[model samples]
Target: MDPSVIATLTAVVSAVVGGAAGEAGKSAWGSLTALVRRRFGTDAAVTAALEQADTRSPEETTRILVDQAHADAEFERSLADWAGETARLLQYKHDVSNTIGGDARITGTVIQAGDISGSVNLGTPGPPERRG
Candidate 1:
């Protein structure tokens, strides 16, 4: 497996586990976990590991995943493939919103991914003249 894939998975696993472990973050955590389970339920080991992730610290969670990936070549490949697919999907659905108010002006071009599906409202549309 490529090192970058491993690295990306490590970071993602750690972040997801860590966020879900916190009390205040449980709602979003639950959503994230469900998404993972729904997306990658074919692998029993991966499912088991993810189920156990909620109880572990971020670092430990990452360690467990890394160990599993290292020990099982197929698992590693599967994980890397999942991560790439997830990233692509996220990019496809990613949304961005930008606003510029008052006399502020934005210079240069703004690059957006996902084909710029989100909004960029520079200002409100109204009558030409305004008096305070």
Candidate 2:
């Protein structure tokens, strides 16, 4: 599994366990649990790992997920898909603090953004400058 995926999973687990994810977080957690149940239904150890995820550190949960992914190619693909969807769903759930507080001087152009998708032009558009 990719590190980003692991990180996202960790965040999802934390949010869900901590009860800070709200409805969307609950939905994501349900989806993840369903996926695991479907994939590793007969594996009690896997199930136990997931059930006790909240009791363990995020790294431990990540390790169990990564180990499972390494063991099963199909599970890995499914997990990746779940991670992508969960990340999208939980994008805004993550706290973002873009503060320009306290004594701040004036600036020409100040842009503060998070998770930008498209191009951002901060300067006036003009003809290309000629060089010697």
Give RMSD to native, each candidate: 10.8, 6.0
Off by over 4 Å in 1: 18-48, 94-132
Per-residue alpha-carbon lDDT of model 2 for 5-89, expressed as tens digits? 8887777677766766667777887888899999988688778777887798767876787799999999988988887787777
Q: Give the 10-residue window scoring lowest on summed lDDT in candidate 2.
A: 88-97
lDDT of 1 at 16: 47
The lDDT of model 2 is 0.80
Clash counts per candidate, in order, are 0, 0
Which residue runs does candidate 2 get wrong by more than 4 Å?
93-132
lDDT of 1 by residue, 39-101 (tens): 556567656666777676655665666676687777666667766665444434434445667
Model 1 C-alpha lDDT versus the unseen true structure: 0.58
Model 1 Cα displacement at 57 (Å)?
Answer: 2.7
